[model samples]
Target: MGEPLRGQAAVDQLLEVLDLKQIDAATFQGESPQVGAQRVFGGQVAGQALVAAGRTVDPARLVHSLHGYFVRAGDPTVPIDFHVESIRDGRSFSVRRCTAQQHGRAIFLMSASFQLTEEGLDHHGPAPEVPAPEDVPTMADWLERYPDRAAAFAASPQAVDVRYINSPGWVQPGDRDPAVHQRVWMRIDGRLPDDPLIHACALTYASDLSLLDSVLSIHGEVWGPGGVIGASLDHALWMHRPFRADEWFLYDQTSPSAGGGRGLAVGRMFTRDGRHIASAVQEGLLRRIGG
Candidate 1:
């Protein structure tokens, strides 16, 4: 949210960032966006760490889940070193732990599980009915209506095409009624390779973008200015079925609980045709500003 992240073309820059460099058999290096960001975006570190974990895994194995915690604020100017540890390899699943560090200090830690494809009993709830993505307004469209915030929006990175069912989290809470849930349709703005890992990693990067907004919905609060400032404590994601991150998917998100200076949000991703593909959970520390 500092400067436009150095590229009008975001996905390309993101692709380069996620493409970690191998330093050793178990270590990889990645760089944050070349901007004056106060801190590295958590998603970049997590996604890069996942890439490190995946590279050390069997090609036949695909990552199904990942849980990560923000250990420290990462330096945006420094390169991150990701160290992967093989926790176990069973007949069906391979587990890995990754630590992302900057200047010898661990900034993020993650554990991921990769599994061979297998048939399983499956059932899921129906996707909620909402206006199609085409019928919704994009950030660009909203910027036209809110001239005051247009400059800030223009200066921020736009890697994904997002259509919000509710107003964006940066909107003042008192400006509108509380949303039943914070819902948005999103996808990478550009085409990607057919690699499933890339798609997964892309989604992982995109996942952290707006998840905390669901938590803010509870108090009719947004982020910045009249709302609360928050930091992600941990994030967990589960890939349910195959899906492309470059295609439109509905992220139906809500906060089930909030207290003790923290709030939790859970979200489900549904494809255009309404198949549930993934679920994500995140908790963040929220502090009211100017209270």
Candidate 2:
């Protein structure tokens, strides 16, 4: 915290960039049958709400957990008004509740907790033995190598810096053996603020990129041309430590179940140094309508 007003100014700028007002609300709105039926990007709301909640707490207290529900399809064009409610301000822990509204209706809600860290006993699951991102080609490089599916891959804004840790199935989709786990490396294209909250908001944006796709990947379903209608129903995240969003972070995802037209996926995010920074869980409607 520099000058209190200066910090506030920076937070305001971050929110403005993440603001949902300029996006098309109609196209981004609702999950009903009449809509365009494309997957409503989950990271959009998650990142926005994280920024909203982060604005409420002290900079020393970093977010450790957030739980949110997608009540309805968000109108992408209408500015989503984020109403932040201060929940608590304990000495070591603080909490915030945020509601995202469009057209006078609540489309999303979230509750997040922040904590001022202190040294404590620690243990963590072993890091996955995957190939380092440096050795692997960048996503853009890979996409250029395969000209056919480049258009589809480039459609999502997230593809800007996101890359897979494994040889992906570019095309020729069919059912294959389900691999329970998957990994990817991601980071923002430009430098971001040093404030912990900004990094966390950026993390929220990156978290949902390929999460649900992990479920489809196991079934060998390529992500285009009628593979399935996938949407995230709810998202929860726990930030275990501090990290940078401009630097590559490994997102390890797994699907424990996919049945009854629904799928559940869990994710663990770790720094290149092997420190566990965050974990996430998401459940989605993954009905296969045919390709």
Maximum-lDDT candidate: 1
TM-score of each: 0.95, 0.82
For model 2, residues 8-42, the per-residue Cα lDDT tens digits are 34334434556433223212222211123243456
lDDT of 1: 0.89
Error of 2 at 279 (Å): 0.8
Model 1 per-residue lDDT tens digits across residues 50-114: 99999998978888999999999999887899999999999989999999988888999999999
lDDT: worst 10-residue window of model 1: 1-10
All models: lDDT?
0.89, 0.71
True-vs-predicted CA distance for residue 196, candidate 1, Å: 0.6
For every model in order, what is the number of clashing pairs?
Answer: 0, 9
- Segments in model 1 whose C-alpha atoms lie over 4 Å from true places: 1-8
Clashing pairs in 2: 21-79, 23-76, 23-77, 24-76, 24-77, 25-75, 25-76, 25-77, 30-73
